[model samples]
Target: MKKFVSLACVFTMAVSVLAGCGSAKTETKAETTGETVAESTAAAGGKLIMATEAGFAPYEYTEDGQTVIGVDVDIANEIAKAMGKELEIQNMTFDGALLAVQEGAVDFAAAGISVIPERQENMDFSIEYATSKQVIVVKKGADVITSPEDIKEGTAVGVQMGTTADFYCGDLGCDVKQYNKYAEAALELMNGKIACIVMDSLPAEQLVAANEELEILDAELFTDKYAIAVKKGNTELLDQINEVLQTLVDEGKVDEYTINHTTK
Candidate 1:
């Protein structure tokens, strides 16, 4: 009888030990899962939707069967990651891009958007990531439009709508033809629909490199300061974006993108 009691007590102690170990494992697993959930939640706060034309090469354009990729795309991706969000780039017209950000239809617009006083009134802009001059692209050895001064009255100048080029050409007293995409305008220039294409210098170079017949004119029209734009008064998001952009600028990430992604 005493021996039976001793064995029963031993079995009870073994059972207790097993139960304690099982409880500990369960608690540990639960804790690990909870930590993973928290980390996931912190890493993702939905997608940060960005509006871009994706027609401006070296800034943003389609490649690899409609995959939007460029310098601005890369920069925007980094900014989104810094903010702990996924990036969703919405390709559209340049004018439409600005309107989308202005109307809060997207988080921000980052398609090499130039920061001008007019844009400043409608939307807040992040720090300038790039500076490019408005340049004239024309056929090789073109005699009529040799310089900025030659782009006077009656010159059929093509420009992307809502761009510094458009604004500058309008001021030039030339016949300004506005297109949604700079690529279209470039095509127009190639087909002789327009005398010249006024665009940012970097993208003009890209176009020139792709088409053997095209060349950028010697004169640069104006300087364009590229930046990301958010709706006015959205200070919180603007601040976050600026913080990330400054970090990138300080670390020379912007220059890296310009050097590597620039096709020309």
Candidate 2:
């Protein structure tokens, strides 16, 4: 009887040990799952994704190799830092950047984008950060286009696609040529493929500074306000961006940024 009782006690102890092992394994698995979820959330929540065309200098352009650095890049970095997130810049075409924001593929876009009614209909814009004018660029010593009025019918005009210049180039009664990069349009102008290039005054200045043979016409076609774009109905992000932009403006940082990045 004693032996039988001892065997029963051993059986009970063995069952308890097995149950303890099972419970430990389950707990470990649960802990690992919890950690994974937390890590995933942190990764997703701590990044600020921005889309931009890196060809627009003094705004966002490649520098020192493949790194994109410019006024807009600096401003976006500051905003992301203020939001306690890391900035991730995605280089894409100007149209693609806008589309990425519209499709929720990115948090925002800042590529010297001008605020216009058509863009406003698709995405919300932050407060204006900088004011820019659309100007005509032509080869120096070219007597064909002395002023904005010279862009008459059949004159070949080059402009970066998806810019305000592209939007208004048709009004000049010229055969508009569109390029993905402002630099490319500037090149086409240099090659005499286009009689003139229409672009924002800032980038036009940068281009002309690099290509001394190129010059900006004395008159500007029109002025536009530059702003950042967020997805439609994303008032939260819009507000955040505006807050940061206003801070930058109030502190005179925007002007400083322009001055620092602009070419003489």
State the C-alpha lDDT per candidate. Answer: 0.85, 0.86
**Clash numbers, per candidate:** 0, 0
* Runs of candidate 1 exceeding 4 Å displacement: 1-45
Whole-model lDDT, candidate 2?
Answer: 0.86
**Each model's TM-score?**
0.81, 0.81
| Candidate 2 error regions (>4 Å) | 1-44
Once all C-alphas are superposed, what RMSD does model 1 give against the true structure? 14.5
Clashes of 1: 0
* C-alpha RMSD in Å of predicted model 2 compared with the true structure: 11.7
Candidate 2, residues 70-158, lDDT tens digits: the string is 99988998888777778999999999999999999999999999988899999999988898888889998877788877777788889
